[model samples]
Target: MCDTCGCQLHEHHHHDPKVVEVNQSLLAANVQQAMSNRQHIEKMGAVAINLISSPGSGKTTLLERTIEAMRDTVRIGVIEGDIETERDAERIRAKGVPAVQLTTGGACHLDAPLVHGGLHVLEHFAKGAGYDLIFIENVGNLVCPATFDLGEHIRVVLLSVPEGSDKPAKYPATFKGADLVLLTKVDLLPYFDFSMEEVRKEAGLLKPDLELMALSATSGEGFDAWLSFLDRRLNR
Candidate 1:
């Protein structure tokens, strides 16, 4: 597949090199659509968040808990991204909020243009219950998702305890661009060799001003701080 827009990569017809000397990121098109999508989300009376993490890092589980905790007080909408299947989307819908599944069809990331289509579909599902917050659950990959802009007001990176504290250093590009870092499954801290101090320090080295939150979605550990952070962003 083509790297830029996920279209099929193929040879182009020979053309005069002198006629074009374009300088652009392979993600140029995605960046443009991301800017437009940001404006569109703002116009929809909602704040958007892009969640990224490795597979099995608990992104969907966190969303499920978040919906259960705030659905009555906060109008929430979700866009689930995966290589295939709407099962994640179905889980969100059971909570009675607008949810749309965006199958990447084998892409490793969710870029801006794909999200634009998701927003329209979500609004249709919203019916009369408009959203105050929109969460875009990106395909569970810590690498490629960091390279594409997806028009989110906040970008959160999650690191589960079982994944160890070295993730920030190992995936610097992803953690470096994060607005917040979430350490999930912390209730299992006693069973894991994870070092919170190292995780914080490494993430700080990459993104000095990045906010950090530690929580266990299952046990509700440190959830108040996470909820408060979202509250602040929405009120902003």
Candidate 2:
């Protein structure tokens, strides 16, 4: 039901004027909602981090380790986004932190409006105590999630060692938008053919001043810097 082409295909190769207008409108609304979300997060006395990565990139594992390491010091809350399953939220809950699972049903990304609801739920879980850090674990897709902001103060994009070093070059939009690029699963570096130098160069090309860190959540390798980074963000 395209208003321009009169064709049923809404996502055709040609740039339909109506489709472009609709997309722009949608993004505009999302941007407004995202700004509101940021204000809400600040009001809750929390700094939000949006974690974006492909599936199996160890985002949840990183959160698990992070929560275990700093839960006593930091008031942590999580909003888990996925196409289905509350498993991630349950895992965070086991670590004894408040987590809200937002199932998109089939959507590949979590938008600000959805996260706004999650923030309220997370606040209710706090019982007016509020949080020091809020983690929005975005749906595991490198592409769509990059285009939407969930009201996060910082956006972290994780690229596991096994995913290969060419990912930064392959997905420039995702890497370019990252505030921090985490090279996770460095413990498996020896097993994979991943090149650290290549990742550094490619990601540097995408974002010259991008902060990159390598860490193994399983082996606790290069984790101190990651924790320190969070500490600075929370303190600032």
Candidate 3:
């Protein structure tokens, strides 16, 4: 079978088995760490929310508004994930809450082990006051973050109005994995061609019973419902 400096060989040796095994082992380790992280969160007397979305979806802006609306009543903490800068964590810290920034270097996603470290840092900031809620803002990506669990009590996915309503259908894996979906930046809905009807229809097709909420961080529109949702979760 010598055609272009190719020698006769069997197909069984074409694939490397070690690579598959390594990947499986890595995932297994991540799952184990995630379970442990959940226990760690409960021990801190807090319920964690893992937030996933694309860049420019106003995740930080939403958090800023939320902290302002709730800081007086709810004990809050934040863990901001990003590829490089500590800018988001700084923003949250300015709001008078404990925030930890975990830079991924060049990775697209934040794994459970990385979050485990962030949780420890947050605990130090708690100073035994005990937190009511912990928000883990995952790096802005619709895909890779869905595959990893940060030991969060709930997973929230955000889709901004300008991003188009077709996102759910295009990125089914992310939408399908969400415990709750937030359609943000509704203030610009009139300017953009994004249809709320299409978003609901397509997202429903993927997750029939998925809880959905629409809000604009800038305008404070629909934000009361969002705060109420968080209140209910904390009460539970």
TM-score of candidate 1 relative to the true fold: 0.90
Candidate 2 ranges with C-alpha deviation above 4 Å = 1-26
Candidate 3 stretches with Cα past 4 Å from truth are: 1-26
* Per-residue lDDT over 100-124 for candidate 3, one digit per residue giving the tens place of the 0 to 100 score: 9999998999999999999999999
Tens digit of lDDT per residue, candidate 1, span 5-117? 55565553434457667888877999999999899888888999999999999999999999999998999999999999999999999988888999999999999999999
lDDT of 2 by residue, 77-129 (tens): 99999999999999999999999999999999999999999999999999999
Clashes of each: 0, 0, 0
True-structure lDDT of candidate 3:
0.93
Give me the runs in candidate 1 sitting further than 4 Å from their true place: 1-21
Q: Is candidate 2 or candidate 3 better by lDDT?
A: 2
Q: What is the model-wide C-alpha lDDT for candidate 1?
A: 0.92
Give the whole-model CA lDDT for all candidates, comma-separated.
0.92, 0.95, 0.93
Top of the candidates by lDDT: 2
